[model samples]
Target: MAAEIRLSPCLNDNFGYLVHDASTGATAAIDAPDAAPIRDTLQREGWTLTDILLTHHHGDHVGGVAALKEAYGCRVVAPHDRTAALPLVDLRVAQGDVVKVGSLLARVLETPGHTLDHVVYVFDDDKVVFTGDTLFSLGCGRLFEGSYPMMWDSLLKLRALPDDMLMYCGHEYTAANVKFALTIEPTNPALLARAAEVTELRSAGQPTIPVRLGVEKSANVFLRADDPAVAAGVRLKGADPIAVFTELRERKNKF
Candidate 1:
């Protein structure tokens, strides 16, 4: 049986994924930035919204929870650590928790960096991961509520996943991120080729996300933790790997 996963563009460039278990006819919305688009997509697909899986507590990521729940009465599953702040979380889940969407089971990964309560959903069977803001296409999220070391550790955890894992990120920021990657790894053939592809895709007004983990490992400067060139470029007058990662993120923040 085929597992159906549909993408619906929500607020600005944010994407909300509708993952359906074709075998069981169960559907779950990854994040609800806006209710209208999600509702429209559900209606269009004739899919019932059974669950709302939230990766983080950002308003743009969870803003439509109340509205969508009111309309569909779906269970809202969010990180247990931030339940006090999360407005409508019905199930407070953490690492090791398994969320079901139809016949698919997503294992929760507590990846804190963009936010202290951020989590990623890994569908092992499908080899797909929904990386909210912790891990982006070619770049990672800015250090907002977390520290550099924390972000680095979180990224390390994600980097351990299978190289072929499909990464579904939060936004359409790959083109701009590739531009920054080129600045750091100007001569990297993989980066150059990926940049060209992203440029062409953006020129056609298409989304440049859902990049593979292997592609990111080869082209993404942030994911190249041991690359000598990246290490040298990000190294301060006197810094270690963590420091290099921090400096690199700082440079990207300004870029």
Candidate 2:
């Protein structure tokens, strides 16, 4: 059976996810931003927390790891990067390694851009990907420890995934991301439609995540750095894709 997922809001815009395998009654929290919210959700759902998957060492992402671990004694699986100061990891994983949460398996993909130790979990059998702070709905995370090229390559790795996959990111920044996207590709119908959808979702106090990766492949300006139209929109028509990507990132930083 596919893993059932629960989305919980944590610390303003951060998101905490619970991945449950029904067959074995095993549940894993994607990243614990806050223990109170995650604990409350677990109690409400009546699910025992067996695992805590750490994407990176960011405070907003792993702030509640210690508390959750202490409460539930759940195994903490973190990236193998020793430089990242993560908390109480029971298992350290890296690229190509598969972490099992009961019967469900999550393939680890190291996407070091937002942070050097960042990794996203891809559950191929369930067609779901937990993109912590790597690939957002319409925007990518800012380059804090990695270079532009490094981030771009990391994004491409995600872009290569099957279009049918559903993406669950770490934060709810789609509204602002769509606004900045419009400045680059105002005439794009996909972007326009997505903007409208986002506006309505936000107004209704809904989360704009678990979005189709196919939709992002077309509508996300950051993912279209190689497209001629996007290059032209940024006034670097014939520039290299890296150059275009760099320009776009710089502009979005200011936006």
Candidate 3:
């Protein structure tokens, strides 16, 4: 049986996901944006919530954790927050830790950027990555707790993943992200095409997540800090990839 993933909307712009292992009937919620919506979805899908996997300490991501845990007794696995910022974190994992949802295994990556302790979950065999807010579709997360260099390193690590893997982020910011991406690479045909498609999906109330990593490499400026074309577009020719990334992130702050 294949892994069944359910992308759910929570809060105003946040997204939550529910992944169920078909072989073991074990289910996991990736960032509990809110409890009611996740509960509703679980009930609708007839899947039991056995685990709550968190990516950061943001309220929009963990807001529903307590409710869901109380209702389902699910184990909460979050970043290494010794202060116990989370309502309940059964385990605190860092880079290279392996978490399990039934027989399915997910490797934890310490992708600190948006937050100092932020992380991403990778189910290698499943070819899926729950990126949280570290890497979005066409843009990366805002630098709130970490520096440009920190975020850049985190993103580059994710860039090493298999090109064919599916990427699931933590927000419904695809259209806006792609819009901002155009400023850096307006002539990029792939970027332009993706922006148009995103416009159509958002207009029709459709999601543009679970995007292919390969597609993102071509379209997401943050992911392509090392690409010569992107560097040239930003007038930073011959500069280090990290320099280009810093400039791009600064521009996004104002965008």
Write down the TM-score of every candidate.
Answer: 0.95, 0.99, 0.97
Tens digits of per-residue lDDT for model 2, 36-106: 99999999999999999999999999999999999999999999999899999999999999999999999
Model 1: residues with Cα > 4 Å off, grouped in runs: 235-239
TM-score of 3: 0.97
lDDT of 3 by residue, 1-255 (tens): 267899889999899899999889999999999999999999999999999999999899999998899999999999995753777888999999999999999999999889998999999989999999999999899988988889999998899999999999999889888778888898998898888889888889899988989989888999988899999978999899989999998988898
Pairs of residues at least 3 apart in sequence or in different chains that clash in candidate 3: none
Q: How many residue-pair clashes does candidate 2 contain?
A: 0
Clashing pairs in 1: none
- Candidate 3 — which residues are off by over 4 angstroms? none
Instruction: Report lDDT per candidate.
Output: 0.86, 0.94, 0.91
Off by over 4 Å in 2: none
Poorest lDDT segment (10 consecutive residues) of candidate 1: 232-241
Clashing pairs in 2: none
